[model samples]
Target: MAIVLTVRDSSGLKLAALATGFVMASLDVTVVNVAGSAIQQQLHASLSELTWIVDGYVLVFASLLMLAGGLANRFGARAVYLAGMAVFFAASLACALAPTAGVLIAARLVQGAGAALFMPSSLSLLVFSFPDKRQRTRMLGLWSAIVATSAALGPTLGGLLVSAFSWPSIFLLNLPIGVAGILLTRRCIPPVGGRRVRLAVPGHVLWIAALAALSFALIEGPRLGWLARPVLAAYVVLGFAAAALVTRERRAEHVVMPWNLFRGAGFTGANLVGFAFNFAVYGGMFMLSLYFQHARGAGPFLAGLELLPMTIWFPLGNLVYSRIAGRIPNGVLLTVFLLVAGVASLAMAGMSTDTPYWVLAVAVAVANVGAGIISPGMTAALVEFAGVAHANVAGAVLNANRQIGTLVGVAAMSVVLGTVTDWNRGPGLSFLLLGGAYLAGAAGAWWLIARSERQARNVRR
Candidate 1:
């Protein structure tokens, strides 16, 4: 028997959808990052293999995201999103029971693809559903809050699961969430028709290959010698091939990131900032956990407890910002936040076992406070300028940028650590990498806003 439910108000139902998908995606992103070592030990993965364990999913997530949005457009956002949730739950089972590093990495790759599919449409549904600008912005703010909380709490949750059960338990956690999401989705998300089209399969293959090559080169380059003929050649060839793929995509009637991605300086600038922010953010969390648990000898539960400040404070920061959202200029708020966060992170490079717990708490809190200020405002700017027709696709682009940013951040930090088990030195390097990345993020905020102002005037036409 089929049961039907009416969404009394699409706004509330959409918000519920946003909250569900954001938290689920954010949890997967952060938890796996924290559980790296547990999986590494159990699987006996080499440092190179372990690097892929993290970067592999991020890369595929970014790569397929171009396609995910298109699929949503061609096949109804609700259908694609529901399918993604199903795939995510099934992949979680594979991740939990994997006997080999190869299997885990493969499972993680599918998981990333599912995440890519789930996130964009869920967010797009929010964007299109909320008709008023103020309501839309606030809904996104609420959406941002959920994602930020999950991201902040991921380490703690990962630690708890790893400690209470085992490393595989981290992946196991997704099943119930998926089941719940499916039920909620059925009730809240309206069914809609989809566009009809043939895929740009050749271009898709080219980009996927490019992503795989680029991921491998970047992960291996630092350790294997970046200047080595083989490494340099791989990067050079991959770069050219990727360029060719873009050109081919541009000429296709059905382009992914149409050449119009460079519509103006504002779009380009905002996109760049999104990238830099993610680059350092994801890796920084992973590296810090390694420092706390592996280096400081803190138990998983204890380590999670230590990380509670970021989780608790992040939502609070959003709550504060939600109160004063429209009053503040998006650019000004973002710049100050990123600058302060960057400085605080750089300060974290000096933390030690002898350091006071209050000091660590302050550092994490400061960074998250900045995250609350910048995230909603930045996303708002991007969506406001992107327009509804392209909303799903533009949001997909943002999702890819954010994931890639995380991959780069993690990769940069890993290179600094050189696969050593030393915890004392890891934090310092992680801090430096994140600090530099945030500084770049701060610059991105300024550029993004400047461009958005012009875009706003143009859109009024």
Candidate 2:
């Protein structure tokens, strides 16, 4: 019994280290938001420049994810993880000292390249670390908990960093964490070697250009007016280019996303559910943070703190539900979680500048719990639905869907949230519109999960 306990404890510790790696990579996902103005002032960035600073990183990170995993397999996990941290640290330093917004955005893209290197490897490492079904489920749950908490807490942390130090302090903060993580990674991780394939250069170039142009168009379209000639032109060119890229990949010797992963209904269903889940969460948070500041008269730090319930309750929910995961019906669990979160979002729609703080807190807390349940459930389902060999690509596909969902949410918000902005009600009607969308996301999850379970059964047979 004591020996068993020691093994379990060691597994848990490794999990902590791995999960922290994930959180560190993800911090960049939102930390820049609160510090955007500071970077702008420090670097003398323009409005367009500031927009690219954030969007560039996201586009690179999203596009290169699958490619990074292939790199990992060709190289080794530990090497890739360490290289990523080094690149991340180097890029962060360059970003801090960058003299212009264009330069800063370029540095940030390098940073994102590092992040793409790290993100898929982190998940792959976790799946490799714990082989037991029960422990794997639990660890994945813990991992998701940390991710959700980080998103909710990032602006708060960024606010504190920016408040006390300069905007550069935010990126500088990664040095110690990266250094420590790298040391731990080298010490603890055993070297696992496999294949060494050549990088698919043409595929990389095509996809990167496609993703960059596509993300640019989506993020810029609202500000530029969707029908603007440049935006329309960009949309047209990228659309055709992407189709061509897909056709080319179908015949490539080393393809990034194999054509048939989606042939399994389980993979398809899981990806759909994953995309919608992240879409609803990220979109809701984007809207809610604005509401807290613009509608409720809160500062960035205060608004982040106001959402503290989301940070605290998510892990708690993940721990509880994951323990009972298999016993409960998968379809019922996902459906209930989404329904509860959507309903909580609807409740939040009624909040105003004068609403009780505690009421707002509880609504977000409930939403967090629902999100907590959905994340691990979705991740585990996707991995299990795909065979072990394809887990890396499965992660990539899941991430792509996640970004797609976010894009869709962003587009919808930009289009419809204008009503509130036009009325000078800033966050009021925006919250209601987002709430309705969250409900729609819940419906999507329900439908896809039903489809997923049926597919799982068919595969088993």
Candidate 3:
């Protein structure tokens, strides 16, 4: 019989260590948004620059995730997890002490690389430690709850720290957590054997180049002129790289991604939906963070308080949806919630400078209600479609795509808001654009899910 770890068991320490890392990764997603205004003022960064500051971490994290999983498989999850913590520790310190925005962005990149390394391996440790399926599910449930709480608390926690100290405190806070987590993991988790795994070098290179070039082109086009040499060159690079990535994935035996997965009904659409979901949700939150702070003249504490509804409702909505998910059609659930979220986001576009705080909060809460439902459902669909053989890498792929959505959302929002120097008008226009994108994604998801259902019925008949 496989040993089960409860709170009282020594093996529970392994769960604790893994949870700590998850908290850190999850917290950073929203925490940095609360600090956005402070960082902008302190570092004298422009809109596009600030967007990069927020997205640079996510971009690297998403890009390297698959490779990180491969590395962990080849070199053992424990070793990779420890090394990730070490890198994260050093990078956090660097971020805290960074003298300029460029330096901070560089440090954030490294921090993301570390997170990419640890995030997947942390899950690996948990699964390896808990051989019993029921026990593992319960443990994962606890871990998921902890992650949700951390993400929800990020803005409030960041606000307090930024108010009491400065923006740097957000990064500095990771230091102690990292140290404790490493110590616990080393003491609690037994070492697992490594396997031979091939790295997808070509796929990685193409994807990185394509995403980087596309973002750079979009971000710089307004300031540099769309037809400017640099902007044109970036677009050219993006097109070529994206084409090459598609070709490379199709041809490679042991690629970073499997092209065959795209053949499944709703598979590609689900991934795209994941991207759009995060683009609207996370990207919108980032935009609101700046709007609350800059245009409304709210302090960090107040801004965080204002944004609480969105964060708080996310997990609550998830919990509520969980009870109903099995009873309802996944497609109907995904489509309905996405449509609701999209419409609510569009409603937010109507907000004027004179709009009341409570009104804004209500709108954000409504949007998050949709997010909460769709988030878990999205993962379930991706995993179900990918099936068991590709199960190991399914989450990684979905998350990577979701992060890419974040990167694009932030970049797109910046492109919209960056064009308008006036803060008051920028947010409303950006919301309108994002709302439109979300609606399009919803339609796509609906069609994809319907097609998948149709195929399933045909098979059964």
Candidate 4:
């Protein structure tokens, strides 16, 4: 009994350390949204520049995630995790002191690189810490709740800080969180040994190039004109780099991505679900943040308050997941959640600039609850499918895809905002796009995940 108590206490401390890292990472993702207006005013940034400020982090983070996972496998996960925390801490400081929009974007890119390194390792550590399937599912739910809470609080916290101080305060907030994460990680989490895994450098480089070109085309298309020479050239580059990367990875002796893992339809579906989930959730959040300030003429503090109704339900959904996780099939749960979110988002498509706050708020709150449930449910399903052997690589793939979704989602919103001069039409259109993404995820979950589960059960019979 004494030994059991000691083990449980140790696991609790380890969880705390992991949660700190997640808080910092997730906080940055949403907190910066509320600071958009403030950052724009102070930096005198253009719409494109503002979009860059947001996407720069996601772009680098998404591009490097697979490499980071490979590195974690090659080097020890603990070492890589600590290194990432240190880098993120320094980058946050640079972001806080950025003199120009360009400087801030650069710092954000560095911050993303750090996040890519740590994020996958954090999941791997959590999986290893709780080896039992039941206990791991519970911990995953708890971890999701912690992350959701931080993200849900981001806008409100950023608003309060920006109103009281300035936009820089949002970045400054990460400093303490970073310090706590590093110290606690060192003291609590046990070190996992490294393996001799090969890093596919060429494949990674091509992958990065492809994503960069695509982002350039998407973010710059509206400003440059879709037919502009630079935009056209970027499109060409994007196509070439993507094709080359795919070919290279297919033939590589040692691949960066675990292709074998993706052979399972369940795994593929989970990745798709993760991608669509981020696309809708992050994209919708960005649009609504701007809508509150730019369309509704709200101040930073007011904007944050307005966003609270939409974001606060995420933690509640995560808590609900913990109770129903094992009772329901993951595929069925995901399908239902996606459907709820999709329908709710579609309801928001009718919203105009003059729409009542409560109306929009209720719609968003319902959508958020569904999104919140999907996050942990999808994660738990993917982890179960991947098993412990491929935990690091699998985690990286899911997160990378999700970040890619976020990058594309935000870029898509920028296109809508830039192209449509009318705030009323633009926001409604954005909601439509978000709705489509969610519904698409639901379809994939039903087709791939449910079918796979049925096949497995049939085999057992």
Candidate with the greatest lDDT versus the true structure: 4
Give the clash count for each candidate: 3, 0, 0, 0
Tens-digit lDDT string for candidate 4 (1-461)? 00111243477778888877778888998999999999999999998999999999999999999999999988878788998999999999999999999999999999999999899999988887788888989889888999899998899999999999999999899998898889988887768888787799988998899999999999999999999999999989899988998888878897768889889999999999999999988888889899999989999888988998778977888998988888888898899989888999898887898899999988888877776788898898788788888888999999999999999999999999999979879999999999999999999899988788778779989
**Ten residues in a row with the worst lDDT in model 3?**
1-10
Error of 4 at 364 (Å): 0.9
List pairs with backbone clashes in candidate 1. 278-405, 279-405, 279-409
Worst 10 residues of 2 by lDDT: 1-10
TM-score per candidate: 0.91, 0.86, 0.89, 0.97
lDDT for each residue of candidate 1 in 13-63, tens digit (9 for 90 to 100): 567765776677778777876677777787898767777888887888888
State model 2's lDDT.
Answer: 0.68
Better of 1 and 3 by TM-score: 1
Clashing pairs in 4: none
lDDT of 2 by residue, 258-328 (tens): 66877765567667666666566655555555556555666656766765675566556677766878777
Candidate 2 TM-score versus the reference: 0.86
**Model 3 Cα shift for residue 34 (angstroms):** 1.5
In terms of TM-score, how similar is model 3 to the real structure?
0.89
TM-score of 4: 0.97
- Show where candidate 1 strays beyond 4 Å: 1-10, 227-233, 349-357, 419-426, 454-461
By the TM-score metric, which is better: model 3 or model 4?
4
